[model samples]
Target: MQDRMTPAERLAAVLMGQKPDRVPVNPFILGFAAKIVNLPIGDLYADPRKSFRAQLLCAEMYGYDATPMYAYASFGAWEFGGEVGMPYEPGQSAPYIIRHPVESPEDVDKLEVPDPRKAGSIPIAMEIAKLCYENKMPVVFQAGEVLTTAANIAEPARLLRWMIRAPDVVHKLNKKVAEFFIAVAEYFTSTFGADKCMAFTGGPVESNKLINPRQFGEFVFPYMKQIHSKVLGMGVHVILEHPCSDQNANLPYYVQLRKELGWNGKYIWAFGPETPLEKQIECFGEHDIIMGNVDPPSFQFKSFEDVLALCKDNIERGIKNPSGYILGVGCELPPLAPPINVYALMKAAREYGRYQ
Candidate 1:
């Protein structure tokens, strides 16, 4: 225990597949923090000040090495000058999206990517990033893939349908969306310092579970690569990448995408809850850091023992990876997850994730 690294050093060292005192306990806590802090979900997402405090509280409470950004994925909608409808949920923070801005190919032609520094939530997101950097808390400043952002403003179904029926329109829209994220990534890396800044540049739209390789190749992959390359070019080594929920089947394609683009950047790919752990270790062991797929929703019902086992199970397999691994929730932990589960998880990591 005396020889173990601090949380910051642990994450950095393990990411390079170097020795860490123990496996880093960096779960993706978002709404979970809001819920525990008693802040209304929508309010926290609206104000970066509250968001920053909530994240600080989470790091203090769970001893997490980092905070996952974006409890609501509507920043792109806000930046694009699209309307967002906020609806209340029965037990949790409001997850909101108003309407699709790009209802037709004609709309794509009108889409304008704004400057990140002045864009809607982009400035607010930067404030939060700066706070995290200043406090020495690692965090993802720009999150959600270009596809998720584009889909939020353009509508998901519409984006997918146009992929087949109106491919040209999709390309136009993706290029603009990708360009916007590149600017945001550049700003974050340059302002906060690349080592402290990270962003999730991959998600559902390109996953094999949701879209076939051919479809992704045609509609999403190129823009994702462009954004990925530009983000790395800014000297941000640890880029956060992922597939949508339960889309681990697309893992191989992600590796291929990185190779094809000659991405020489360090990366962190969060494994989905349903993504096979064994397979994740087998495939990602060579080059990147793999975070776990701990399903956050289950923590609502699962006993402390259940959460403990889940953490231990993942740690056992994750620590076997030759590259690097970190314990992470499958997605954002919901408001109802038992607070005890947080302790249960960290306990498992501390005890089992030790580098014997």
Candidate 2:
């Protein structure tokens, strides 16, 4: 029960389904903290040192179980001229098109995979990984899943349309994207030790609310399995399949996939406020780690009391499996979330996250 557990010890304990001294909190810091600390968001995708300093500072100030030095945007499509727009605010993560470049079946044959080491923002991300590793902080490297990457390349709306209009093209594109991401994962893991690398799949590919079980099986599941298998083959722990919508209906599919792929339930299936904790815990059971559910809006617009209440509710939902839970905002923390509210989340985690 030592408070000074090594990062490896803490993470290994969690992955092994054992209680550590307390639950781990691994929230991605953005918005106000970046500005208050004077870390510019624009530099995050371009400068590894700036990103590393900001992330390390947040980890030091807030006390997280792990440090994740993530590029603010996906490197592949961004480098290939994938319709990305400026941030909603001056110091926020840049927003990309709901649509993509590979709009038609013909576009699939023309899509080129960007090399991770040479791509637009990937070198910076890799450099950040080196920085985090040099600092001796465990780093989780976030990457987009095949579907997300495909969506990024062809735009989400176009890809969704292609699912029904041109399923074969969608399948081909996803396979290519999956393979590309695997290479990226391999490069980073090899460069910065597998133990320090955690692969992140962004967006809601597994959500039944967004895509049906049939669609997921055809378009999403295979690519996810490929990505997860590739990462595991490289001896890296693939942490979160960040599906923000309702995954209850497809939880069985994920559970079955994990069994087939030999993934221990220790891998995370992160959710947001939209995913009720009762449903998530009931569907996935005690072995699974639930990473999110605290509404970002509360942190952005609500009172500290309200934020505390949200934290308490999320924690209470996983009280029976404290070691299998992480305290975090439903998605990226809003750029304007109050520092006190952020601290409130950490305090609640400390108070309620104790392993009895």
Candidate 3:
């Protein structure tokens, strides 16, 4: 462990299968910090300065290695002129989905990929990335994955119905969505440069707990593979896939996909609490970094001591293999999670996280 190293260097070292000063800590910021600072979510999405300030706050306050510039809600569909209705509670957090477009197979043909630089929330994201680059802060920009975007466009429930009732149409829609995702990535890379931004972060929410692995392979994997290959080709450092469920069964397939695409294991296969760590280690190997198994609910509701103990145990387990692990919540840290617990988790990673 080097005594003096910059956050970006530490992160880059870890991703390159090398030991850093300590395990890099990355926490997902879900635009709540903007609200905390009395900035509306919409405004945060619209103004790069506001978003950058909020991200800097999270990094400075929480000691996070990277600042995630995530959009307020899902934006992939919105680019295609599809309507998305997000319901927010007054005092409580947790976004509720109220509406989406793409009701029938005919709807797929109507979809046209929008210019990411000019469309929906993407311009705002690009601006924020530019600001982060100017400030020399490592930024992790979130681009919705193909399958996740497809699900977003055709509301989850409606897509599920289509999977069962109209499989062919579902495949066509997914392909169209995947193509759009590739275009978006190309546009972002062209604007921000592949090295300036961290890998794309978004969920493949259509998998496992929501649908089986067969459906995942059919609707999710192909598109994800396309996006992953493109990003890898551009020499991107990481492509963190967020699938917040027990995706152990899909591990082998993910590994195979990486092999087929000739991807370095630096990219993350971020999993939920239900994923077995031992199995992930065995399947993905010692050099492949894994992120998150800590359940967000536990950290939010449990005692700090309990959270510390869990984090300590996880760090110990991770170092058993060495240099290829990160400690983070399975999903975004709940907005209400105790700041002390978050600090404790980071502290545990610093003290107990080591490569030998």
Each prediction's TM-score against the native? 0.92, 0.88, 0.89
RMSD of 3: 2.7
Worst 10 residues of 2 by lDDT: 71-80
Error of 1 at 291 (Å): 0.4
Q: Give all candidate RMSDs, comma-separated.
A: 2.3, 2.9, 2.7
lDDT of 2 by residue, 48-108 (tens): 6776777667767777665756644333466454655535455456544543567668878
On residues 1-356, what C-alpha lDDT tens digit does candidate 3 reach at each position?
A: 23356677777787777887777776555554665566665545556787688767767776667664755436566666665443334553433334566777888777666666676666767778777778775445565566667777787777788889988877888777766666666776776677765666556465566778777787777777877787667756667777666676666667777788765636675777777677777766555677746777776789989998888887776655443777777776776676677777777777777544
| Model 1 ranges off by over 4 Å | 1-4, 68-71, 85-94, 261-263
In candidate 3, the residue pairs with backbone N, CA or C atoms under 3 Å apart (3 or more residues apart, or in different chains) clash, namely: none
TM-score for predicted model 1 compared with the true structure: 0.92
Q: CA lDDT of each candidate?
A: 0.73, 0.69, 0.68
Q: Is candidate 1 or candidate 3 better by lDDT?
A: 1
Best-to-worst TM-score order: 1, 3, 2
Residue 261 lDDT in model 3? Answer: 73
The deviation in Å at residue 41 for candidate 3 is 5.1
